[model samples]
Target chain A: MIRFENVGMRYGAGPEVLRDISFELKPGSFHFLTGASGAGKSSLLRLMYLAHRPSRGLITILDEDIATIPRNRLPELRRKIGVVFQDFRLMSHLTCFENVALPLKINGAGSGVIKKYVSELLNWVGLADQANARPATLSGGQKQRAAIARAVISRPKLLVADEPTGNVDDALAVRLLFLFEELNRQGTTVLIATHNESLIRRFRHPVLHLEDGQLVPSPLRPIVPLRDRAPPPPDSRRFSDPIYPDAPGEGGRHG
Target chain B: MAKRRGDIPLGNDPASRLLPWIIGFMAFIAALALSGALVLAAFSDRWSAGLTGTLTIQIPPPAAYDDEAGFEALQKEALAAVRRTPGVASATLLPLDEMRALLKPWLGAGADPRDLPLPRLIAVTLEAGEDVDLADLGRRLEALAPGITIDDHGLWRERLTDFMAALQLAALAVVAVVALAAVVMVIFATRGGLLAHRESIELLHLIGAHDRYIAAQFQGQTLFAAIKGGIAGTGMAAGTVVLLGHGAAATGAVLPGALVLEPMAWLWVMTVPMALIVIAVLTARRTVVNALVRMV
Candidate 1:
């Protein structure tokens, strides 16, 4: 669970990028964060992910105050949250498998568990064939999926994503959302920031709309608690041969 | 816990390339200096023991008019006079053959001992508990045989000890300076690695890397580099010291201590690499930890 009240953030000495921001995310809920360019969506996500300290106001994640928690304890809290960065910041030198396995490694998972779980996650994300490929060789959409796999590989309690579906096609995008929705039903709170309007309408999740660093009120609330709904089947089919992203004007460079 | 997963990607750091060589060179210098100090310490101990409570008396040969028997009698008289001196433990007239053997190292083995006119020398040992007054002893010997000299070896031992102690101090100073230089180089290299991987480090932090985890990556690289450099440098230093000792012996010169190292001394020489490795690893760990704390 994340709660932010009157939180304002800015780069050192710069004008405030996010002002009077406030929201409460209940446990096991999923929401879409929507805004235009310079709407401070990324800034807000940065705070939620514990990347930057808020310049003012209170932000709490999982009952720990971001302002007062000791720096040494940050790692334990951070491990519980997964993040899909906007640029898909994978280490260029690591293979796709290695990148995805990093979170588990950091969590001190056994080698057998790491190899087994990482392989299963990569297969689910349609990247099993690209396991040994480095980030530089992967197409844009492939890179995004690899980043997504890494973020979710640890099965983090809270997953924050920034433009995670940007480089994928509509079908692939919907599949990724369904994957997120599946994760939500399992009680992982999910927040995704994006500029895609059609995906927003299709999913119809509660929207945290930001304009000029302010959150606009939305009448639509949570449809129901995720625990009230039946979980999706484990063998639900996905786009397995994700070799090509068919989204308009964003087809991957490789295929 | 993944094998070979150093998330920082530090292998590409130019610091990694240069650390071993730098540490190797420093270790070499430190080993040599340490060996020199050890040898000097051994020399000081040996010389101090050999010369303590010993004295020598030089009796000039009889004048031209005196017959061989007369000169012999004069030598006996002077030896008796020294024997009667207070605090004299034992006195005996040194033989010509023994003198030749003692001088063999300085004067080559081929040199004829009988060719030169030599003075009659008296070997004297003093009582351990008693201090001999050399001025009185010299005066008494001179009365019996003019131009007699009592050489107590006191001034010579004092000067030699002072000189050797200063050399020991200098050797120790060299070891200290070399250690300091190694620390500085390791610090610089660690800082370089930190700078080169700044972005990866920031990413590491965001993804939940503990400060200790990041430090261990640097330390692991340092551990290998230090071992590589330490062994090579120490091996070279041992070889060089052995050669130096052999060269001193090969010259057939009577140099003090002869640069020969005892087995224990050689064991001491081996510590240089172990010490160098420890210094490098510790410096790297401290540097990484300090630098990481300052990171965003």
Candidate 2:
């Protein structure tokens, strides 16, 4: 659950990049954030992920105000939110397994839990065989899958991703959104920022479109409410290529 | 804190690579300085205690030159008068052969001591913790022999102790400066590490990692480096101290006290490395934590 009211943000003496932004993302909702090249999508995601404070106005996540939250409690608040970056941002020296296991490790999950969940999630993301390989060795699609796995490893309450599927092919991108959608069905709120109009039309979830440092109404097809929308029709590619695995701790759903 | 391998990639960085060597050098100097202070303190206390309750009396050879019996009579009379003093436990005229040995180091061992116009000396021992009336004893010895003088030894002992204390203070000051240098070096290394791993640090921080977790990883590396350097430095210092002790023992009779460190003093010297390790770890932790707190 995130609420931002009349928020304006800028970076150190720079012009305002996000102005008068206000939105409420209900629990278990999924939304795609759409914008042009200089439209401040990443900056808005940065504010959502607690990387920067709003220069003015109020932004609250998980019932705590970002501007007034004590620094010591920021980590706890951050732990409840998962973020997937456009660049993947995996540690180059770490193997894929270690990269995906980072969130769990940061959450202080027991070693047994980390091994079980990380191994299972890697297998589900079609990266089980490459688990021991470094990020440099992985293909772009493999890196994107690894990043998504890491973000969802801790089963964060809210998942905010900036261009989560930019590196993958169209088919694979559709499959990855389904992965996030599955997590959303399991009660995780997901907001994805992207410029892929086809994927936006195909997925048909709500859209929070940004333009010229401000939120604008999307002039497109009507978006479906998250809970009322039926799941994507399942196919062998979804079940066979990447095992239809539930998020790390979400049990019995795939079965 | 279980080790996080290559999380920050600090091991291969220039700052991290150089940190251990700098710490090792600082630890070496600190250990040596501390050992010097410890040995000096031990010797000063021993020499002070040795001179505390004892003194000497010197009587120049009788001027007659041929009056051997008169000189012996005057020596006996002076010894008798000193023995009668209340605080003087006993006084005996120093034998000439023993006096020759004291001068053997300065004069050639082959030279005969009898040729020199050596004064006849009397060794005085006093009651433990008792004060002797040196003025009264000097008057008595002077009446017995005009040239006789009482050597209370207090002034000479005080000077020796004062000199040793000053040297000890200087040694400790060197150790303090070395420790301060070590702290400053650690601070710089930590800062460099933070800068070098800024992206990784931010990634870690953003991925639900606490400031303490990031600091633990940095400090854990520092702890290992510091411990390794500390042991190397302290080990070298101990070996040097032992070799010097052996060298001093070869001519130990020349100096009144040999630089032999007691077990406790050696234990104190060993603590230099431990102290250095503590300082490095704390500095790295504080620096990393403070820097992280400034971030969002």
Candidate 3:
């Protein structure tokens, strides 16, 4: 859960990019952060992910005050939240498999667990064949998928993604949304920042719309809690079966 | 393959590649300076021990006793006086040929020994735990044979000891300066690496990598480079010292055997590489931690 109250952020002496923002994200909730270019969407996501300290006001993540927490303890909190950058920030030198496994490695996951889970995640994202390929060789959609896999691989409690569907086509964007939805179903809170209205309409998640350095809340019909939802089918949880039923296991391979 | 934990990509930069070579060069200079200091210390100790209870007597062939027989008679009388002194343990007169050989360096090899008015030298050894009244002995030798002079070797030995101390101090200063410069270079390289990999670093930081984790990557890289360079530099320095020692032995008379370092000095030389590795690791770690502090 993340809460920001009257938070303002600026880079150096520049004008405040985000100002007087107030919001709260309940545990296991999902929301879409909608904003135009330079509407401080990324900045808001940054504050939520504990990447930047707000210039003013209180921000708390998982019930701990962000300002008062010791710097050394921040890493533990960070491990709980996953972030997918707009640029896809995959280490160009690393293979897709390595990039996806990075979060688990940082969390000190055993090598066996890392390999098995990362392989399964890569396979689920339709990147198993491209697992050994470096980011430079991967197409934009592949890179985006890899980034999403990295963000979700560690089973982070909260995921903040900036423009996750920005560079992909509509069909690929829809598939990526399905991935986020699956993560949410598993009790992960997802806040995806994007300007794609059609995808936002299709997902029907609550929106935190940013305009002129402030959050403009957009309400929607309340969704049911994750615990109240039915469990995923046994075959859906099995690695042998593809997570996405409609897409062919070998389809959507990008270079 | 799954990437190992704590593995960072910053070391791929060209700046990182140059660190080992730079550290090696610095280590080379440090090793040479350290070896020089060690050798000088050994030489100083030996010279002090040898000269502490020793004296030399020089008798010029007075115009009154110019001939060989007269010089011989005067030298014998001076030798007898020195031997009779309370603290004088032994006195041995230098043959004319030996005196000529000692003067050969100042006068060319072609110079005839008989042409020069070289002083007749008598080496004196003092008894242990006994002090010789050098002035009294000198007066006694003068009464027995004119132009006889007592050289206790103290003045030249003290000056030599001072010279050696200054040389050792200078060598130590060079080592200090080289070490300081090495630390500065490593700091600059770490900063360059941080700048080059800022994006990856920030990504790591956001994804739960601690500052120490990031620093350890830099530290490990720098330490590896430093150890490689240190071995190359120290090995080269030791080889040079050994080669010089051999050359000195071949040249004979140029340097005393005591000037060569003892086994302990060699051990001290062997530690230069290890010390440089520590310096590189510590410098890199501190620089990285400080740089990361400025980030979120």
- TM-scores of the candidates are 0.82, 0.87, 0.83
Interface RMSD of each: 1.0, 0.8, 1.0
Off by over 4 Å in 1: A217-255, B1-5, B47-54, B59-74, B78-120, B125-150, B253-257
Instruction: TM-score winner between 2 and 3, please give it.
Output: 2
CAPRI tier of model 1:
medium
True-contact fraction per candidate equals 0.53, 0.76, 0.79
DockQ of candidate 2 against the true complex: 0.69
DockQ score of each predicted structure, in the order shown: 0.51, 0.69, 0.62
The TM-score that candidate 1 achieves is: 0.82
The 0-to-1 C-alpha lDDT of every candidate, in the order given, reads 0.84, 0.85, 0.83
Compared with the true structure, what per-residue lDDT tens digits does model 3 show for residues B170-209?
9999999998998999999999999988888999999999
- Candidate 2 residue lDDT tens string, A59-81: 99977888889898899888878
Clashes of each: 0, 0, 0
Which scores better on lDDT, 1 or 3?
1
Ten residues in a row with the worst lDDT in model 3 chain B? Answer: B1-10
lDDT of 3 by residue, A86-192 (tens): 99999988899999998878877777878888888888778999999999999998999999889887767789999999888987787777777776766678999
Better of 1 and 2 by TM-score: 2
| Candidate 1 backbone collisions, by pair | none
What digit string (tens of lDDT, one per residue) describes model 2 on residues B1-296? 13337567778678888887888899889998998999899888888888887888898987776788888888888888989999988888888889888887888978877777789888989998788889888888887878788777889898998999999999999999999999999999999999989989999889889999999998989998898889988888888888888888777545644567889988898899899999999999999999998887
**How do these models rank on lDDT, best leading?**
2, 1, 3
